[model samples]
Target: MKKNVVIGFLGTQMDAGKRRKWRPSVQLCEHPDFPVERFELLHDARWRSLAGKIKAAIQSVSPGTEVLLNEINIDNPWDFEQVYGALFDFAQNYGFDDEREQYHVHLTTGTHVAQICWFLLAESRHVPAKLVQTGPPRNNTPDIGTLQVIDLDLSKYNALQQRFERVSGEYNTLLKGGIETRNPVFNALIERMEVVVSNSDAPLLLVGPTGTGKSDLAARLYELKLQRRRIKGRLVHVNCSTLQGERAMSTLFGHRRGAMAGAQSERGGLLKEADGGVLFLDEIDELGLDEQAMILHAVESGKYFPLGSDYEVTSRFHLIAGASRDLAGLVAQGKFRADLYARLNLWTFRLPALRERPEDIAPNLEYEFEKVGKMLGNQVAFNADALPAYLRFATDPSTPWPGNFRDLGASVQRMCTLSPRGRVTLPMVQDEIATLQRIWKDAHADADAVLLAEVLGEGAAQIDLFDQAQLASAIRICRESKSLSAAGRRLFAVSRLEKKSRNDADRLRKYLEKFGLDWAQLVQ
Candidate 1:
């Protein structure tokens, strides 16, 4: 019978607490159900004595159990994202090629958060593992206790956790332009695209506001399809919004010699060049009706007539179209071709705006700083206060991020450009915040204040400026929330613990009543 290979970290705190008690790792190796071939114990570099004890315990428990120590470092166990990122990278880069031995992740050891990371990695197939959880006996009887195998997909603790892991893993790669995975709608869209790219060559439509990473995603999808051998040629991209009748026609479908004033040489358009590859049209909704009709035929039949050429050209290519405006509305207004819309509407994925995914702000900020480091040939650092200051305003519901990531990117670009000695100071962050506030409020005509005035009547103008801003933000969050409890939880994240009993809804109600507002009026 082949023995199993168990992999996990050392439980320094747990084992040290009771040295005479039966340790979980020792019992795991001794357990009759789990016969170990080799035990790989990941431990801290400083824990030599602990490692020696663990090795001794394993040897004594099963005598023949082979044990090895793998030293590693965790600079900060409390930083969830950093720890999770390091472990995930380790798991991704680890080699697990022995087919003769089955692998299990011993979850009884390590920090609680570390255990969660292990489960998530395994659930996503990144670690290719099942969980082994060892529990102590019910009584203080001198016996090794019970053990349970956790299959994430089937376990009561996390039946759908596997699905979330699968999605997050892909986002860590595919939609990694920034921390865009925090948006559920955006995450699900990319997940769908993963399947769509592999199975279909039909045109895909990315509908979202400008600067939502549509263009980047289109190129990425093309690259993925190329790797899958779904497309055999290079990507050809065109911005339809920048072209017109003659230029658009000549640019997309190619032109015969002297096809137009500028066609002094023979030219095969982007579509022909994209033969056997992907042709991405950015802001495709801006295509003229004639251009739209022409592209529709090419999309459907894989054939088109180049400018000033009667002979037809065939280009078998996958089409990816991106649009910022509402294409369906344009179709209704007769500005866009309905037939063309129908052709690309098969797989439409909406990329949510940045303000809509506030959770992504910090990761993206760090990512931007990393980019700055790469470009400047030295790392750039943010003052400890800089990040929080920036995020506080970026996440404000009243802030309208007109350019989405474009706006955020420009902000970072400005800050990085202005950083002194590679450090972004609090003053720099505050200046940028004030600039953003002025721009947003000036450009959008204080929509929030207008709404507040309409909602609160004379009370809005009478309220202090700070109170008005707070009221607007709270109301916006409340309106977006599913329930009063949900809204209250968000509003009182720090204060909720002080409550003797959890009645967030009642607290929210009383707060609203202070402003002579009710859930009904605000939510509506």
Candidate 2:
């Protein structure tokens, strides 16, 4: 015959009473009819001794009953979301398949809130088990338990799906119908992101390079929240890179009259403007270390004092921080507060760069043309040849979109502007490619020019772009090599094998000589 498996928490009250007594997990097993084949008792980290004693007691009462002690770590047992989430996650992954054996949860143990969570999970079928409420023997009658098997399948509830659809529609508007996104991971991320923004008031950190729609997404989130009546006010956006010192502080926390020079009147800043709404802090990595703590306090407590104020003020608003730089590196370098980083990192999401999402290029290009049509009040279309040619170049590995979507948007803008008669032809595509090449080259020119000029000095000015590009490649190879021979072998991988015996170093020396450079200079 198959036996029953019982899962329960070791109640603190049961563990009390100044003697070795009956814990619920043990009590259920000690019952004559219960006949528990196994007991799984969850215990908080600090009460391991109590759990051990309970486990021993259960084994002593029923020698054949297998007891498994599970340790749960929690900062505060009363935190409903944390506890519920932990238990739900555990149940979600636990094996619920035992062909002959039955599962039961002893609900007579644990805190009231934990009991509620257990019941909810069991009721929702998240935890597949019958809830067992155990009681002690009274007046010589044997102790017994009541089993409740609740059937609450969320799928059976149409209201849940309706609500989900409504929430999804809000986000669809936010994403402009998600025109360019087809990747399964990105689609799943959107669903997860909607759930996050729905309930969380904690700061959200968008980790992606510039032009990845960080600010736009933040604004759209605010709009979604407002549509749901979750937020009552408008979004307040600020680029922290544009802020500095006192001006930054004043802009974020407001300022009293006479707080500083030219402080003619009291001013409500971005934080105040975002009261009951959302504040999108772009380039937040640029914020000074001095301001990091102040922001942290406001985030944690929803309280802050305006500049030159005698009393504290409160502004409770959701925060959305965007950063292109490595905020973690800055934190390690003592440029940002660890506390602030921890808080903002709770819901961090990285928006992939345009180069990383090639599947999106065609749709986004079409979107750009549609945008152009609306802006110019004229229909615009890319010719068959022009469209494919632009897409080929856009998705090529040789292109590094440093500015990401901003570069893509600019490319579309330029092509559309240059496209006469609202039709993008082959000539327009060619011109846009040339413009992009020049733009990308100019962006990277400073670094390359510095390296080349330092190595070649006056000769760098005389060297054409082709030779300079070759020298840069040679220098990169030399830096990566442990010896001149390795660099030479890599540089002339195909040609070096043609030699009867490889004289890589000699060949490398001659190659460097032609550029008026040497091995030492290349490596350095």
Candidate 3:
């Protein structure tokens, strides 16, 4: 017969000072008289708390069972060394038990901090311990054994490892080519694209602020499909904004020799170039109404006539279009064709702004550092302080980032080039931050005051003396103001009034100094 398994649950709290307090609860299966003496306790504060609870539970269940207790405090970095000292001390003082012990741990903490720390401690010491958790009971019963303990799933771990490898590989490839991943928005966008590409064959529409890497995603998706053998053709990228009138039609539809003044011979258009592959049209909304009609026809019926030619050509390719503005909004204004809008809107992915995902900052920073290092031919690392500043800068809800990722990449490259000895230091980071803050202040000083006053009360107007914290507060206010301003004329008028506040030369100068803004840039 198999022995019944038991699970022990533990919880702990850590103070601001990093001191730990452990609270434990244990539940068991059959075999109440099983000797608790077979179990050994690790000496960390958290484990000690767990051990105390386990001991109490054993005493309640079976009073005669004997157990040994060990105490360890891991409050600092040096505590690991002390743990080793304690282990050696234990070996020197008490001889090892002849019989190996069977131990089970059921961690019930909502956060993974203690559990991960405990896991590291166990692994470092080569101790064999089973980890467990108390999930919802499978069956509804008071005594039906709701506890669960199992080995960690290595396959999930391996999958995550593979994901990180791919991310790192891409980071290195982009970095080597002098690109930076400063926007956290791209990570989420990539995940979204992966799902979109895998699940649907419909044309994908990438929409976001300008410079948010719509074209980049298009190229990457094309490459990704090729790698997976999902598509047979290459990715053909074209900037629709660059093609206008006759030029736009000729470039998109192809032309024969002597088709136009510049045409010396027959040439294939982007549609033919991307046959069986993907045709990525950037700034698709910029295509004139006529051009949009032509593209829409081609998209609807894979057929188009070449410029200066009467014969129609058949084309088949995946269509991926991108725009910096909302196509629906453009349609409402009659600037974009409704039919083209309907076609592209079949599948759409909206990329979030950079300020949305703060957690992605570290990874992006690491990626940027590696990129800069490769470019400069020297190892570069962000100072510990630099990350926090970068996050604060990137995530400020008020900063418009009109250029998005392109702007951020340029900023990071500038920081790397300006850093002393190729190492980003706290002061260097601060200086860059000061410069950025100033630029932002000067650019939006008027708009900031108007928006700030509206959201934060009229008192906000009188409190323009800015610090990093205050600037952050003002940014939040500005974002809210922009949203509210969209409602009606009164609010719009308020925004106009706010814009005027920054125009006061003396007030603007003080505002610039307080926020570390460059007044000349603002004036210009």
* Per-candidate total of colliding backbone pairs: 1, 0, 5
The runs of at least 3 residues in candidate 2 whose Cα sits more than 4 Å from the true structure, single-residue gaps closed, are 1-150, 156-173, 446-524
- Cα lDDT, all candidates: 0.82, 0.81, 0.61
- Top of the candidates by TM-score: 2
Task: Name the lDDT of candidate 2.
Answer: 0.81
Clashing pairs for predicted structure model 3, backbone only: 43-71, 43-72, 438-516, 438-517, 450-498
Candidate order (TM-score): 2, 1, 3
User: How well does candidate 2 match the true structure in TM-score terms?
Assistant: 0.61
Residue 44 of candidate 1: its Cα lDDT? 77
lDDT per residue, candidate 2, 267-379, as tens digits?
98889888898888899999987777888888888899899998878888888899998888878657888889999889988888878878877888888778777887777
What CA RMSD would candidate 1 show?
21.6
lDDT per residue for candidate 3 within 1-524, as digits (tens), equals 22222222223442111332222233332133332333344445656655676666656655655545656454652445544455445435644322454444445542354455445434543334456554323456343234455554445577777996786566444422333444545555555667567556678898887776677777877766665566898888898879977888888888998989989988788898888889999999888998888888888788888888888898888889999888898897689999889989977888765555445545655666677778878776777777677677676776566556666676788788887586777777777777766776776566656654544465555563554345544344333432322322322344456664433334434544664443343323
Candidate 3 global Cα RMSD: 22.4
Which candidate order results from sorting by lDDT in descending order?
1, 2, 3
* Model 3: CA > 4 A from native: 1-192, 396-400, 441-524
Residue 239 deviation, candidate 3, in Å? 1.4
lDDT of 1 by residue, 85-185 (tens): 87787776778765766678999988888888888888888887789998776776437877778766565556477885765466447545545456676
Model 1: lDDT to the true structure? 0.82
In candidate 3, residue 38 scores what lDDT?
Answer: 36
Q: Which residue pairs show backbone clashes in model 2?
A: none
Give the CA lDDT, 0 to 100, for residue 34 in model 3.
Answer: 33
